[model samples]
Target: MELVEKIKKSSVTAFISRIPKLHLAAVAGLGAILLSTQLLSNNKTPERQRTTISLPVTVSSPSIAPTIAESAPQTNSAAQWRTEKLKIRNGDTLSSLFKRAGLNDRKMMNFLAATDDKASFNKLLPGKTLEFSLNKEGDIEQLSYVLSKLERYTFSKDNERYSLEKELREPDIRIAARTGIINSSLYLAGTDAGMDDKLIMELAEIYGWDIDFALDIRKGDSFRILYEEHFLDGEKLRNGPILSAEFINQGQVFSAVRYVHTDGRSQYYTPEGKSMQKAFLRAPVDFRRISSNFNPRRLHPVTKTVKPHRGIDYAAKTGTPVWSSGDGKVIKSGYSKYNGNYVVIQHGGGVQTKYLHLHKRKVKTGQRVRQKQVIGTVGATGRVTGPHLHYEFLLNGAHRNPRTIVQKLPKAESISTKIIDDFHRQTQPLVVQLEAETATLLALNSKGSQNKAL
Candidate 1:
């Protein structure tokens, strides 16, 4: 029995010596568990003594949490290069521009020869910008040529050669609204409402088929437009397409919403899915006012005699563009004493339109023209008149009023049944928003009036 006890003690000592330093506590606990089990199995130990010899044995593996110093820190690529931006001024050549960036002509020529897309860099326009990223040795390591707000060309240097990469970014489009009430003219009111000329013209063209801006616009007419504002790098780049609009003309409300088809074709339509475009425009030119209307018996300004006026006269500045009302072919484009430079177009379904007293005819005989295409410019070359366009619309053989005849003409095709549901899904929200905004504007105006009266 003595020999066995000595052998057991030596075996435990050898086991303790073999363990790692970090795991000494765990090994000691495991050895205590083995000794307790041996004491419990021996018949010589008393029950009370065995119960009193209590030792809690917990064995656990050692774990060390990683510290910050264990791994390498990450570095930003931009930190390695310094950037220099330059804008090309007028009369600045590529060599001069490169010199401005601290680069010599030899380096410029080397870069140009190494780049495969040298054609785009050949013609550098004024006001375009370029960025050069240099290394610590002041050598051009990267180059970025900004073509526009959304497009740029990047070149990266490797050894003595450079590789080209094109990058394109899409502008962030955000929806916005504008409202205006006409006091005298649409143009003035639109400008007063913080809109540019291009946006005003677009608004007019949207309702051009129904309202003649030169003749039918009234004092109380109001308009609310929902449109897109393109933003890049947290700044507005430009205004995008008009999403929807509402026009209240003399108490008659007209609504138009834009929808983009799956094929990327965009057009305006009413809430009922009918197109807002008609077969003919209500006015062929964007004139300030109408000088004369169609009259069967009227005293001529030049002749001072009773003569039948067969067309509406739009008074505008000379060189004001005149557009074709619909798709047709020019049947006559000539100069005469009464109608200086004029163009007559013959459309399908026995419809024809005539433009008299043009500064210059853009279309020739037998030439095709499309709707809204500029065919001529308003002029005073006729027998007697100022700068005005005499626009005539004829159906079959009888002349018709340009303002009232448009309502009688058929509108462009409506949304097809196959995509009517999709159209509604896209346009319903815009229609609702348009209505809500117009309502808010009306409420504000009413409150302002009440305050004034009080």
Candidate 2:
């Protein structure tokens, strides 16, 4: 029995000595995990704890926002400018305009006193604009008076003083053409062809020396004109001067080309370079019709007796402006019992022109007048029936017909030979444009006629 006990003890001791090192290490690791859990529950962690577990880390840049305190002040150059615009209305005065702009009379006077041309404000037309750029203190940094789309006056605030600058914008000028056929009157024909009143009047004035618009218009008379159309922002602003024109009166073609000379004077000339402007205009006033022609054996309407009517009577409206026929000196301007208000002008080269029965004489007896200058207005102050102008043209003290005398008068100098090539170079393109337009018109008219026949 003692021998068996000793063998059992020895077997137990051998088993303890044969335990593996891997199992011992696993036991030690389990004990370490249990100790770490107890430390985490107590909220006591090491300052530098190393870990073998892999974790995801996202790399990104840090973001910071700016505050309002860092923004620039209103008075600073980087600050935004406030703008205001005001349009001028009819019957608007400087004070009224200023009041509308939230300004006082003193402020307006201060602005006016700063400007050199105060008279420009006097002609403040309606539909103009005034623009203002303001600073932080509500002070005007810049002020602009827009006179037109092409013109403006800018007053910039420089310290305490304001500097004025006139700004002008050049308009885009384009060539335009129109064709008109006269059936009754030139005015009606021109208007039907989309011509404005001013353009029609200018066309008449261009051909006034050769054609009698009031008396010489026929049923088949036609005209073609090339002129300027001023444009801004792709829209038509206004009609400009006539570039080239052609008028066929009584089967006679008369052409006039605009030529700008070296002296900066623009004049119309024939294709052969003859001046279209004669020394005398065809008629003194824009007359509606001839009330009475010159007749030596006609009976006077007032006298009830036979008398010689040396002057032609032009029937026109009262207050119609009468123009000087030529550049001359006024010899007599007075109101008489027979002539009423009359003006007698002595032109050069033994020529004299007389205007009778005027409403008001614009020129004095000694005032030198230019051609086309407004000398008087038509009136009924004379011993006559109604408002009519008794115009007399005297060649060396003999009464001649004003309408026929223009043909015999001296003409203005034509484009000189030195500038004739320059004239042709500038005006030929305009002439070709007119010709092309006319050809197209003719072709269209022919096609329309054929269509009508079909």
Candidate 3:
């Protein structure tokens, strides 16, 4: 109380001495301005005063149990998209093909077995193709197929198993050829005929040196061939082997009998006992400069340094197939970082041969092979200058030219007296059958010609 009185007395004396010049408005205005400034400062948001806080935050993380509320089931792609084709082979049944293709729909099984026999029997044979579709998960979404004989069938699969549906579709036929000229390439001619390159090359291999397709085809040559042209309903699928063919080159005539022997071995033989297969094959390499000619000088293609090449190099196209020069056994087939892909054959009597720089090795070890059989394809494997076949022939551990060894094959021994008699007895009936069939075809053809003439 005494301090307040003293501050009041002092204020009154200071006011009297200054002659009291303060206006009431000025004092009230000053007090009001001070109050307003304090109110504004208090209302304004404070500057974000970040201090270096070193307090450890006891972060309480929420309970994060992985959620599993009705997740979608995983669908398998193997079940979704179909395998596209089922090869109908001898003794193949609907059930078996489906099973082999990994289809497990029981309803489809029962349906295929039940109804279709009366409408169209479900018999499978070689050279036939069937098609099917699958859902996104690779399950049998639908079943459909076309037979080579122009028959068709379809099926459907839902969550329900399978149901049969009959269908009729027109087949598309495409005529193609695989030809080999004695001097010109059959592969080239086949290309002109709109055949697949692979098929045409295969045909040359099937005929091989026997016909000399590259060297034998002449100008104005004529040939007529019959073969299975595959179709998938309205679309053509694949080309099959030549069933029959007639060739006329430079006034010489040739025909092949595609005889599937009862023993399941099929071979192309001349009308006589002579085999179309030669003892040694004609050299597949055509006139490439024989570099280093069976030499002991070793050179590497990459390093371009001295390295022994066991085989002779003959430059050719990549993917050109290499054939065994004679009947032999596959002793080795594999890839080497140095050798590339290679094949070694152990012919009888210690006559071994090796082929290197292959794009692919078709045969494996211990596989018995016939003359001119394809062992591998040519390529620039390992260290090579472009694509070529490196072929080596060794007789009793000595290198020999394949050309030297393969002029003609040595003839087989003559049949024994008893064996000849037995062979004659057995072959006589077959010869008669063959003769009759040949005569019938000729007669029919002659009659048709005469009719055309008339």
Candidate 4:
């Protein structure tokens, strides 16, 4: 038996020695797997004590797998409505603008249909801007159109329905003062002192009853005015009416203040509550000059003989407008051999005005004419030396000098006693402001003159 055992052992040893190194490794791996299975199957072994097994490693580049963060859905927080501003160009309509903005025609039609009577969007002007707010679905949320600095229109969507709103902005009004000295012409001096044409015209009209702007404005004449200026959002928009004005013409001072009564009637009055306007304007026409004054024994320009001149002559360009000196009714508007085209208006208190040598008569017989209304235009159609207006003023069917007769006519009505106090209260501050501004300007001018002389 001992011999047999020795032989068997020797045979096994030989078999084991003949196995290759790779086969030995394979067998060891199988044994390790079996040992791990046995350990995991044991109920006594704790789950925490278990270790993961590793397989044979291949030394190739690893491919990256997409993680949960990369594969998840993305969100855009900035995806919302946006606004676009479009200016109206010539020939651009609301429909065309909407089309260019990628908005549908149906919405525009709906918007127009809703705001048809409430607004006038069809009349779009150049340089006007239209702002539109659109949603993510390209639908208009709000639309705004600015008509002017004071007017605006807006259409907004509320609960799928559009409504139109018209907004009117009232400008803030403030008082402004200006002073001017006439050097050559009122227009030039007024404009040089920061006064516009409209203001200058207004100033002339306020004093039109006494002064003829065409012939009466003289050098060294100065004026002070207090008026209103309108502002919007801290920017100047335009000028308003004059509150008070003081004019010094030919060394004569005239002060006037505008007053509005409780009955809505407004007029200008002096500090003593006397009316600044007269019953008649001194001149019937804004003539360049008096070609012939009221001279009874003057030599006739056409007849070349000593004759009694019945009226004054105003030299002006042909077609120069002739105004009625006062309110009256025309008694005759006819043509004559000696008067060419003429108009005769009879005023209150047996007063009559005759306008002769007219290019054309604008009023007919029996027509009621207001003061300063154009009745005819100057012409040289009659027996005259040049294009001039022959104006005659008659009192009680007798001829009188038109320029001198107007000064003797009835004065304008004064402010009533009931409203005189109110007038003074409102106009006193304006007058004071005007006087202060004028004094300051005069001081500055004097200082400037002295500096120049030095």
TM-score of decoy 1 = 0.71
Worst 10 contiguous positions by lDDT, candidate 4: 113-122
For each candidate in the order shown, give its overall lDDT on alpha carbons: 0.88, 0.86, 0.62, 0.85
lDDT of 2 by residue, 105-185 (tens): 887777777766676677777899988777766666778889888899988877667888898988999877889899989
- Displacement of residue 416 (Cα, Å) in model 3 is 13
lDDT for each residue of candidate 3 in 1-454, tens digit (9 for 90 to 100): 9999999999999876775345444556667776866777776676633334233344687896655653655466544465568777788776777777766658455555544333443456577776768665555666666664555566666445556676655556553333333335455566664567665554555445444443445666654444557686566667765544446667876654344544666554433433445555545543223444445577665787886665567676777767787888998998898679999888776788888889898899899998667888878888776888888878799877565455444643333444444444544444455445445655776798899999
Best by TM-score: 2
RMSD of 1: 15.1
Instruction: List candidate 1 stretches off by more than 4 Å.
Output: 1-113, 118-145, 440-454
What tens-digit string does per-residue lDDT give for candidate 4 at 1-454? 9999999999999998899777778779978887978877875755545556665554898899999979976574224668888888999988888887777789788766655443467588898888888888777777888777888888878776778888999999998788888988888888988999899888888887878665678889989998899999999988988999999999999999988888887788887888888888888886666788888999998889999889888899999999999999999999999999999999999999999999999999999999999999999877877899998989999998776777788988897888778888987887888888777877887899999999
Select the stronger candidate by TM-score from 2 and 4.
2
Question: TM-scores of the models, in the given order?
Answer: 0.71, 0.75, 0.44, 0.64
What does the lDDT read for residue 295 in candidate 3? 53
* Decreasing lDDT order of the candidates: 1, 2, 4, 3
Clashing pairs in 4: none
Q: Higher-lDDT candidate among 3 and 4?
A: 4
Displacement of the residue 320 alpha carbon in candidate 4, Å: 2.8
Steric collisions counted per model = 0, 0, 23, 0
Preferred candidate (TM-score higher): 1 or 2: 2
